[model samples]
Target chain A: MDTWEKLDIGLVMTVLGMGIVFLVLIFLSSLLGFFERLFGTRRSPAAQEPKPAAPAAAEEKPPPLPRPPSKPAPEPAPAAAAPAALRPAVVAAVMAAVSAYLQAEALALEPPVKRLPDDLSFWGRAARLDQMMARRL
Target chain B: MSIGESILRFLETMGFAAMTWQQAVMIGVACILIYLALKKGFEPLLLLPIGFGVLLGNLPLAGLMAPPVYETVIDPRTGQAVQEMKEVGGLIYYLYQGIKLGIYPPLIFLGVGAMTDFGPLIANPRSLLLGAAAQFGIFTTFIGALLLDFLPGISFSPQEAASIGIIGGADGPTAIYLTARLAPHLLGPVAVAAYSYMALVPLIQPPIMKLLTTKKEREVVMEELREVSRTERIVFPIVVTAAVSLILPAAAPLVGMLMLGNLLREAVSMQPILNRLLKTAQNELINIVTILLGVSVGATASGPLFLNPRTLGIILLGVFAFAVGTAGGVLLGKIMYRTSGGKVNPLIGSAGVSAVPMAARVSQTVGQQYNPSNFLLMHAMGPNVAGVIGSAVAAGVLLSMLG
Candidate 1:
């Protein structure tokens, strides 16, 4: 085609091309948002609100009175009571099996009573470190 | 032999005697490219090899890019007389075949996809509109290219104009892909302009961005993007590919290969061997392909073809297209800024021109100049990646309409 004819064609294309691009992207954005809402891991606020209260209600019977040293004493009782509820020596046997699997001494296999919180921030940092190492390699 | 006779014989056989004025001029151009690569550090990876290739191609009587001649030969396997085209040209000519047959650009897209991350785009999907807006340059330049016929020795057909217009995309593979398909003869200049402008993104985009944006707008800090899930990241490429494939099947190769590479990158849990292969494709394979593609494209710019008015026009139009694309993106960003109650930074609009990390980095740099604490790199990356898909879609449109 001649230059003028071609120029006209180009003008038509610019409008149509840009328009389609915007339309497609808008559609995609809406569709993606729809998918996200459909498959989201978050529970509704109404569903979650009922759950926390139930746990709190069951724990209230043990705390009619509060004394300073007694508070600390009651904390260990839960752990000690949990084992008592189970079969006799079952907890110890489980620990013994773990120790055997680890190939450690029987006394050394006594699980630490002190529980450490699994820090999410620490895991995030570790993941970032791994990514950085991979990139460097 | 007499002394005069010996001197005459040597002079007749020397390269200087055989070299035309055009070839000499091309050699000078090649030298300038080499200087740019070495001294100025302008895309040295590609430019150095390209400059060297130009020199080698321009050497008269070297037969480096001589057309092969066919001869009838009896084939042992077929037991018949067949016309066989002997390999008469040099290595660069054979390498050029990859570009001619439209092989290199798609392969390059694979590497680009492997390196790219779609998280930014997925986190802020609205940036896709900005990416589409940046393509205003390609169409605007198409009109400009066609209108340039009013000037002497500067007529571009629809095909040529389409090829030239894509330089606005600020993407090397997309530009090369379109040019190779539509205007193969114009490949050298189109490829060079696209790459040169891409390398100059830091310099070319900032002024336009600043002109279009205010100091306050540049300093606007965007809210942190929500973290995209792994499932969303994995689904993105597949969805885009399926969508584009259904709409514009012509773009299937460029878009498909790009998505394939991204799938490989995101499929980290597939296997260690597969991950290693993906890494190799991103680094080693891309590096090797780039060297070959650069040199081959350079070899095509022989003196007669490259020294014309059309080549110069294409280069000028390329920069203009880039500037226009930047402006278009920034304008859209301004609109979004006003609509969103000033939550968006207009500086990231320039990243919509899609030179990948380079344009995004330019956005970050310009934004930082206004406000040091305002980090726009991650935000700009959204439009940066969207620009890639936008340009590919634009190419597909042009191909379908004009191919």
Candidate 2:
């Protein structure tokens, strides 16, 4: 084939190749969407509803605990200072372990939590700290 | 013969006496590749073996890549002429048959399929578009390579151009598979260029990604993906394999093997026996294929053929393909960002270039640079895995057209 003919074929290939790729993938996307509609709803309600309620219950029960204040009230300054000093190291260690475990377990299991929210956001960090404090109490 | 004459004849047979400047230069190139693999840690698993293969290939007297020698002989009883094997070929020549026969790449894809988690992809299927868009680089480079036929000493047939273009897919096995079928002559340079650029993805993709997107677009924190059900995951490989194979039968071997591996991985939850198969595919089988594929491919890079203007063109076009692919994905991402009202992070689009988790990680790193809280890894993985399917499809298209 001459240069122009080859170039024409090349252009045709360019269009045809890109067109087929898009078509196939778009088909796949819609198929996945269909699957989500079909199967996702079945599990989402059962999986999602209980999680928020359990966390909420945990939140409520933590506030009612009277043991935390009683033990630390007399030495509040030192108690606050000690945890403040130790918090960074502990959080860092925990984050490392969590990330390592998540990476190792990513193939086999669903993640325990969907997102690594704590390290990335201030509110998440605060919520985690609150949970830790409540657990200690 | 005198002792001195015998010694002198042995000296004349040595590799040093037969070595050319091109061979010397190729050896230097191999050493540099080895250094990059060892010291700088550039895709050490493949590059190290490939570099050593180049070294072995260039040694003039070694004959490591020699083809089998055959002679015509007459059978005494039958009185018919038959071809007799006079000498067996070299080790790598035998290993190279795996690539030449189109066996190794699909097997590698099987391992990749077994190892990959398609949950992220199934959750956000629109990322498939980004994967398809990145393939724009492959076709664009195809046109560019064809245009290079006008240049002096750099003629590329359409088959060669297609093979060269696949390097832009940033997928080493697919490149080799396509090249071995279409333009076996260009296999060495194309494979080298493909793997080298894949290793350099972090360096190549970011600048284009940054250039294409705004600061706000890069920092867009995407919502967490919905949970994919076990049934959905299991059905995925089957459906995809059926759809893609029916649509493009030429892609069956690759897509078929890939889905089979994935089926093994995902179906283990139901059939416990499949776990053994999945483990083998993911680890041992892949490792053996990788070594053979790397060394045999590198052995094809003989001094005379490799040190040429065409090889240089392939190397240059490789980077061009990667740049355009990154740009293509990022541009599509920009469109998605606008359409989604800034919900989509455009940075994740660059991961569409099929370097597996490496491209995805680059997206994450670049996104984190702009916004500390932005977690694009899982989001980017959607496109990252999608790119594999996209490239395989692109290869199918080219093969149907050219092969």
Candidate 3:
């Protein structure tokens, strides 16, 4: 503050000085706007990137929502077929979880796919990227 | 002139040494700043108040701006000065006190913590790296500031420079809190720089984001996130609060509030509490602080304090810092895209500036333009949220190094 007070110019003068600078900046910004319209390069195809237009559509794709994977078709299907009294609570639990996701508006990236089950055979002889991903970008 | 008249004349002349025209013009400029802040959505919350505060603080004999820290007051009904205006401090004075003593900002961090969502960041730990990368801009600005001795009326020590550098994070509360502690004098410039550039993020980020990432890169879509289990969600806030508090005691207040808010939201049993907190976060707290923060921050821009070449230098350096942060985010995004075989939308990289979901929203908005099916918000949230932690960590480093 002592140094500030010792400065030769008064505060009002300093403010006035900056006000001029602000005006110049505003004016220059407007001038650039005019020139940009006059000489800016035209938008080209390169202006936008290409994606896997049709091929991405073909991807069997992950299910779009967070769905619990289909109840296993394996013979353990009786567990899903359990008695009605026990099933009601299980069904309510599932509904609540699903509702929570919906309420949170959890954005599923395009389609949510269940990651394939873990298996040494699947891992050892994995299908090509296109076979697994379904969509090609 | 008579002796009394002559004394009056001499004083008036001395006062007029400032020139009424210049003062009036300064006041006009202050009003214009106020108008831009209010009329333009350019940080209207803080800018409007700050601009008005600047105008009011500088006006002579308006007697409103900075009432003497303590002043005489009268109670007409009681016919007494019953309640002395005991240096309770004028609004801007109190605000400046908050900044000077570093009071409100840390509390603000607590509120911010309560409002934040760390899940996205937790889901994608790599966003933390991008967030950290963006912090490079803060230090870069510090180096740029070192070179700014060539500018007029600006010479910051290393600590002061570091305080100013955190403005690159584009987190106003943290910047103010940090500067208030490390370099109280530069708080005026640093706060101005942080808030002004934050308002300019839309204008500043897109160009750098475009320049750094290819069109293909922008269109990359991230895989869906797994269900972050309820217990996993609940543990997030508790663990982070403990981790951050134990690790960086300075960041505890902010992290605690933020995580506490998330805890409220995730606890699942506290719907009423969540409703109350969510409403306050969205409305009351934001509105009140925004009014105070904006104006008070603006008040720092009093004609003398703000009307310097250093302030100008800070503004320019601020843009550079923002650009650097954007560049870092997008570039790291490109790297992630490559490593993941184009599974990451580099646009999410731009969310690394920690504008609290705004930058993340921008990434989501822009990505949808490139690919209608793209859902980048949660992905962007990773870096967007990490940017908050990143800035807090940066603040901790500055405090420890220069506290």
When 1 and 3 are scored with TM-score, the better candidate is: 1
| Per-residue lDDT of candidate 3, residues A34-115 (tens digit) | 4335443233233233343332333457667875655533222221233223344444554455545434343342234233
Candidate 2 runs further than 4 Å off = A41-90, A97-137
Model 3 TM-score (2 dp): 0.66
Q: What is the TM-score of chain B in candidate 1?
A: 0.94
lDDT of 3 by residue, B187-252 (tens): 666776787788878788877877887777878767765434455557666766676677568766
**What is candidate 3's CA lDDT for residue B306?**
64
lDDT of 1 by residue, B1-403 (tens): 9999999998988888899998999999889888988998877877887888788889987777777778999999989999898757677778988888888888888999998998888878888888988999999999999899878999888889999999999888888888888988887788778877888998998889988888889899887776676677778788888988788887788888898889888887655567987998799988988888888888888988899999989999999999999999999999999999999998888888989888898888788778866668899999999899889988998888888
lDDT of 3: 0.66
DockQ of candidate 2 (2 decimals): 0.38
lDDT tens digits, residue span B19-54, model 2: 999999999989988998999888998898889889
Range of the 10 consecutive residues with the lowest summed lDDT in candidate 2 chain B: B367-376
For all the candidates, what are their Cα RMSDs to the real structure?
A: 12.5, 8.3, 18.3
True-vs-predicted CA distance for residue A90, candidate 2, Å: 6.3
Give lDDT per model, in order: 0.82, 0.88, 0.66
Q: Using lDDT, rank the candidates from best to worst.
A: 2, 1, 3
